[model samples]
Target chain A: MRVRLRRQATLLATVAGLLLAATPVAQAYEPVNIVHTEKVQAGPYPITVGFSTWPLRAIQSLDFTFAPDGGIEGKSGTLTMTPATRSTESRKRPLVRHPRKLEVWGLDIRALEEQGDWTFRFRLDGPEGPGEGALTLTALEPPGPPMALNWSLSTLPLIGLVAFLAIAWRRTRAEVLAG
Target chain B: MDLTAPGAHGVRAAATPRTAARGMPTAMALLAGSVLGLVGLTWDVQWHTDVGPDTFFTLPHLFIYAGSALSGLAALVAVLGATAAARAGRPLDPTVGGASVGVFGRTFTAPVGYLISGVGAAVFLLYGMWDLWWHGVYGFDAVIDSPPHIGLLLSGIVTMVGTIMVFAAAAEHRWGRVGTDVSIALTAANVTITVLGLTDVGGPVDAVHTAMAWLVVILLLTAAGFRPTRGGAVIMAGWLAVIQAVTWWFSPWAAYAYADAVGLPVRDYINGVPVMPALMPMALIAVALLIEPILKAARAHGNRWLPVAAGAVAGALVAALQGIQDSIVYTYPTPGPGTLLPTAVAGALLGALAGHLGWRFGHMLRLVNRTRPEGN
Candidate 1:
């Protein structure tokens, strides 16, 4: 019975050691590198941020993801985003498992107001240690629909005005000449 | 000017005594309704920016509806009154007689302006329905220049133009300078609304286009449509300034407070500060000042080209002055000289066209009022 117990313990220790060895290999696969408008290196981690709506206009949604050099398999953290121009309170959200990506932490922000540089601060506490980092992104003028589309829509009123005036003028001319 | 003279279109004029007593109320109603409509539109824009769209029956919408309803009702009453008097074999009130137009095989008495205004109100109502449906289908518009919005603005412009016509005609009927003053005020208000509605052209980058358009249209209309009166353009510029300043000062705060009250998480900042205030119509004063001398020279020398020349000068001045102001004050990127030069040329051409059109339209209105026929 003692020899059988020793064999089982040895088997469990070998499996645990193998599993531990595979973690770095899995983490080496690198969180999906998203093309981002702004990137920052927070203590031991690289954070990439971008507006989900392209061209980074005002009043748009934001996407932020953090990939620590050591990976996020056993890490916990928080992200705080604040607009530099606004006095509004900074928004704090827990770093959680990204819905779409594995081994990554992310936050999806619904709307950003005003156009300017927004600061993003990240705080992470993990097996390696605790670290902080900040990044700034410049928000642009709210990108509108295509210029052609906007100009065409705006010109409708001018066309209508001109048409109405032409018709009125014709009718009045007819009436005056007849009188 | 004899108030009872037979006007154009075989329409008999109303007796002077009755017109003197009854005209004041109708004129006052038209002015009030049009002005209220302008105010409502301004408020609606504020609501759109601050709170986003809520319901079809918001407070600002009610204001617009009330204004339209009042103007339409007043015009309807005048038409019905004139038709009744005509049937009863009484002299048509000059106030309502010149407005006679045939519709559906019956003679309806309404000033051309009021008729136009009433039609505009009806169309505006229809467009409002379409706007609601559009919002439901495609979602709320992020910008103001939606097709339905453009339709509504065009109708509103027609309504205001009609109001101006009504007052201008009244002024011709010896209603005094007060009538002229009211017309000028309405013109200013119309210009303000037009500028506001065209937000695309009013942006910091596109302000030059707006300035050119404003200078040409306004200078031409004021110079040609109204009788030459010293300071008329100045008064209009003053009115524009006052309306812009007042609305700018109060609208954002009111919008923000309402949003907060409703628990909407709308951001009030643009860049690092509060959203930019409404653009001022200050360049118009320069155009107005230029118009005065041109109008005087045209009247004194009977120069046919003077109106066009005046418009060109006003347009050039507007482009240069406004371009400089926009760059310095708004921090908008300075447009190249190439951009400015073309703007001036386009402004001059447009001004000339507007001058010709305004002159023709103004003459048509005067002729229609002076040739009323007996019995019909």
Candidate 2:
């Protein structure tokens, strides 16, 4: 009888263990973040872009503007942008330029939406390196939407159920004694 | 019949007070829950190839696995502690003999607590689901990202199985208790799934989190030899607070410093990926763990320093972990200003509220007796 009791206890534990061991996914479904920034002390500042998220899909928008250090001479410059997929690293996209100060408020280059080999090259026409490379652009297509699989709210009903059992069990024991 | 046996009546009567003391587990559960809330929020982790061989070998995977393991360890600790403590006091009444049988004709020899564990497992899973939705899926914009996709699936399975166990255990307890092997099997299956489901091997930091969790479990079990009730709860809470606080502070600092050293931006924004808010939750977890033990100990001992000490430990850990974790990331890409601050603030506030509410609700209620008539 003792052995049987021990076995039963073990079974109960096994079940609980299995429940916990199951893979637990997150509730949120936010997009991956991989943008970096640099503040230049001189006139133009340099900015490097980093991308993460396998199976490159698409970028909806890329917008940038110039913020002068001390004086604002209607900051105008000839700029270039290039993109290369992962596969063909050397097949670089040429620098597509705009003559005016602020070109393309929001550029959506849909052509770069191919499968393989992707990288973007940027060069702003200004003084050499230091403060001459200031640029800010928004990369679009932040993942699909946040997922709903949070544990806290999901477990509220369970809390209620546990309470019910505890109460019921306590009562049963009480009755067995009273009887 | 044995109620009249030599010394049997004395033993059975003694069981009454201890049985009454069974009420203490409920309080411990509340305390553990609060601690879970705290650590779950405050712990921070980062994955990188830049660390030294020693750190590279240890920390990362620990944080990832800590969540699932903690729940199971907590339940096991509760069971073993209660059973052993009761045994030390007086021989249990043989009247509650044989395994607790359920309505469905199931039978098991383990103490009634085994059956009660189903309730705890269900609560754990449900909490995971809510967390996934609020923080994991909907809260973050990285659903399509590589690693989170794995997180989504793993957390989902845990939640589903946990729910099933809840109902199954309830049915077992209410009807006829299932054998102990069934419970163990349930746990084994869950662990297997998590192990198999993990896509990333995880990094060094994750390993640290896992080790800490393992240590916490061992400490909890060891504490059973002491006061059982008080010791178990305190150790569990303290362990959780320490682990989470350390993790919270470690990640960003590593990221920030690495960025400065490597000459990369403090923060990085991948094209489709969203910057993560992993740190805020770490702070929250630290605060919650701090409050649980303090409140429980305070209510019991009525000592001022107990609460203060708990708070100080929790706060310091949160700050320390935050510092360690942020140093690397703060300088990497520069957190778009005010990005992580809000999460930390929100997590702290929520942790405090949860701590107070959990204590009140858990301890305030008087156990209701609703036993059915005999031979019904």
Candidate 3:
């Protein structure tokens, strides 16, 4: 009878262990899935650029991750972006940790203002040496209706307000004159 | 101000006075809300500069929305109270301190000021959906001049104007006039700071900004001069300075503490001084000094162009003041004859128009006291 009881306990333990082992590890944050990646050679240092959203759309927010061949250590970098049209000034800033994905340098929920092929220039300083490279990313037109159409729809409130105010004014005046 | 009376169920009320003092709390609430909104804006600028845009529901945004919500809530309370009071056969104008607007063909009456405030609040809140769509299309804005952002800020200014009207109705009271002065100052600072895109270190746009900003200062000053209170415009200018001083301290501290609390590290690069430490036209006292005497002369002699002259001089000086501020703060090319000449030419036109407009608004405010304008 004792042997049977021991056997039952062992069976329960084995089943629990199997279930625990089969289950995936808990995610500490909302996981950022890198949908597409591009390779750029910054001299001696080979870097990988990952985008959370594939078929990048202009003005659409997406997470970007930049990782070297190995882990990021004893390294710093700056990112400069020139728009596709190149009509505006290029934006330059230091590369910082993605607000959500803290382990690597990234831009979280950033978007390209203009559509077409935008250039991203990266200057990296690392333990191995200094390296620089450029990547041209194609940002398709923004999703949904044209922005002009959206603006036309959005401005309906203003028109409604004007009409309402006019009505309110006239009605109030009529009542006052009657009095 | 017993707003808790189970409403009159939509009865029409008279536009007569009940108790002038009862509306004080509501006026105070309006002022506090507008000021809080300004405070939040200052913090927001710092947040954007110190930290990157991570999400929409950041702390600074909450402050801003909360402040606007407070203003909207106050306006709603006033409108409903007045409506209920009117339905109960109580007079509406005294409660609203102005004329009453008949709602639903006089089913409900709303005060002009409170109603305007309510409309502005509704627009601001509703505009958020449009702004959200804009973000979806445009992503995070690299600059503050996004179309939706401009709309949102403009609506808030409308609310600020409503706040001024709320006080303007009760301007007969000493405290009421003081309230008017403070609200005007806040509105001016808000316009100048938020519209900094209109003015920058250099370019022709600065001229445009200078002209508009000059007109705003002159208009508000001229309007305040018509108030019954002595030194009203000067007091407004002093309040502007006070806002500057407070913002210089509050902005940095709020950003640091909030970022620390949230465990979000700030960016390494930041502006040397508080973002908009004293972006307002600080030479307002000088303008007020000239304006008061000019206003007095106009009243005694009825010289119409005196206002134009006052506005023109104030405008030129305003342009000069801006140039000086730029030279001191930024290494932007000093405004030579090239910049100053065109700016002054544009300033004169806008300034003159503002002066005329300011007179009408001020005189209207004076008449609201139910007394002779000159007597006030």
In terms of DockQ, the best-performing candidate is 3
lDDT of each: 0.57, 0.32, 0.67
Clashing pairs in 3: B11-B87
Ranking by TM-score: 3, 1, 2
- Measured with C-alpha atoms, the lDDT of residue A8 in candidate 1 is 51
After superposing candidate 1 on the true structure, give the runs of residues whose Cα lies further than 4 Å from its correct spot.
A1-164, A167-179, B1-10, B15-17, B50-53, B96-98, B172-220, B260-266, B271-277, B333-336, B371-376
Q: Which portions of model 3 show Cα errors greater than 4 Å? A: A1-34, A42-47, A65-78, A87-108, A123-132, A149-179, B1-18, B93-95, B133-143, B196-203, B211-215, B228-230, B276-278, B290-292, B323-341, B368-376
The CAPRI category of model 3 is incorrect
Deviation in Å, model 1, residue B280 alpha carbon: 4.9
Best by TM-score: 3
Worst 10 residues of 3 chain B by lDDT: B1-10
lDDT of 2 by residue, B61-161 (tens): 23333443444454455435434534465444321221122322221122233333433444445444543443322232212222333343334333322
Cα RMSD (Å) per model?
Answer: 20.8, 16.7, 13.0
- For residues B1-376, write the lDDT of model 3, one tens digit per residue: 2212224433222223335556776777677778878887888887766665544565666656766877888888888887787777754443244455566665556666676677777888877667777666656553565556666776787777677777777765655677777888888778776556464355643554465556465546445545644566677778888998899899888877766666666664455456665466767777777777876676566566776666766666666667666666655577787777667666666677666656545555543323332224
User: How well does chain B match by TM-score in each candidate?
Assistant: 0.81, 0.30, 0.87
Error of 3 at B147 (Å): 3.3
Candidates' DockQ values? 0.05, 0.06, 0.09
